[model samples]
Target: MHGSSSRIVGGDLASVMTREGDKVSLICQTDGKPDPTLTWTKENRNLSNPKQGRKHTHLLTLVREEDAGEYRCRAENPHGSANKTFRLVVQSTPNHMGTMVPLLVGLFLLKVFFCFLLILATFWFSNRQKKAPVMREDTTRG
Candidate 1:
């Protein structure tokens, strides 16, 4: 009698997204008459010992930008072998507050500059009005 052929039962082969310095896990569940041997690789390079025993969970801790790439998980037994592929995308966290602070300060300074210009213009108009000479009527009728 022949044992059941090894087959991939459950796992996620979809592209995954994560941030730098974060942790992630990829699971690869398999079913067979005899327990299948699991293996993992990144960018076609072997990961050595990436699997967590029979749980088939590959843990990535303190993930970095360099870690973003194609990952593959394979399971093999005497009968046959099966595999799955995954894509990891790493993004850097943006500092919104830091960027907004400078923008806000620039806007405030622009407002102050416009207000100063308005005050100068009002003062100049008032001085010009005061400096105007009053018309005087002729002393004797022609």
Candidate 2:
């Protein structure tokens, strides 16, 4: 679905679609008497046009997790300027690290078991020393 007369004199327009965890492709279409200046913008920030001299369609690919947001395409000609907005949703796949939580917990428990064994050994040695017999010589009856 396209919106109403977002058209201008120079004929610069941009459209794009994006999905999460996938690449985003921006297509810019220009049709003017001479040629129009084509540019891209996201959240009002200006974007450099990769296709400088070409009057045909241009495609820009962005592959990044952080590149998920609203993107605006501005086509400017001598007559006027038109803009179209696109919402990009970048979905992140389930990470393998998330699946390792249980494994990590098991390893931690193993470590705790080893520590407990060390503590038990120390306590056993201390108790054994305390139980040893102590001898004193009898000086008067010898």
Candidate 3:
């Protein structure tokens, strides 16, 4: 979805997800003068930037089922603010394997949860490393 400073003007943000919980993507396009900061929010909470850039396009990857919700994109500049909304629906395959299938699904879900947590942790640690030196240099200068 797109938004503008004076008037929220743009197209719908496009997204795709697999029913088997394999992959996900979110794309937003916006057009405005002086450009606008594009951001995504779910349930009123601002999401972390998936990438660093000053462009009007934002992309998010590998979305999970829990990420499904009313997604709003807000574009804001010194002039004004604008926004757009989208509903994300994550589908899952039906379980036809009976009782044992439920247990297997539970375990699989747990595995995916831990894997996501691990990825998040790794990203956090990597970001810390990249910023620590800059922070130290600034402190030393002061």
CA lDDT, every prediction?
0.83, 0.60, 0.64
State residue 85's C-alpha deviation in candidate 1, in Å. 0.9
Provide TM-scores for the models: 0.62, 0.54, 0.50
Checking candidate 1 for backbone clashes, the offending pairs are none
Top-lDDT structure, candidate number:
1
- By lDDT, rank the candidates, best first: 1, 3, 2
Better model by TM-score, 1 or 3? 1
Question: For model 2, how does the per-residue alpha-carbon lDDT over 1-142 read when each residue is reduced to its tens digit?
Answer: 3223224333333334454446556555555433556677777776665333223332445446677667766655556556556666665667888889989999999999999999999999999999999888889996
Write the residue-wise lDDT of candidate 3 on 1-142 in tens digits. 5544534444555444455555555555555655766777877888756322234333445556676777777766666766677777777666577778889999999999999999999999999998885534456565
Whole-model lDDT, model 3 = 0.64
Q: Is candidate 2 or candidate 3 better by lDDT?
A: 3
Candidate 3 pairs with clashing backbones: 1-12, 1-13
Which regions of candidate 2 deviate over 4 angstroms? 1-21, 49-62, 107-142
Number of colliding residue pairs in each model: 0, 6, 2
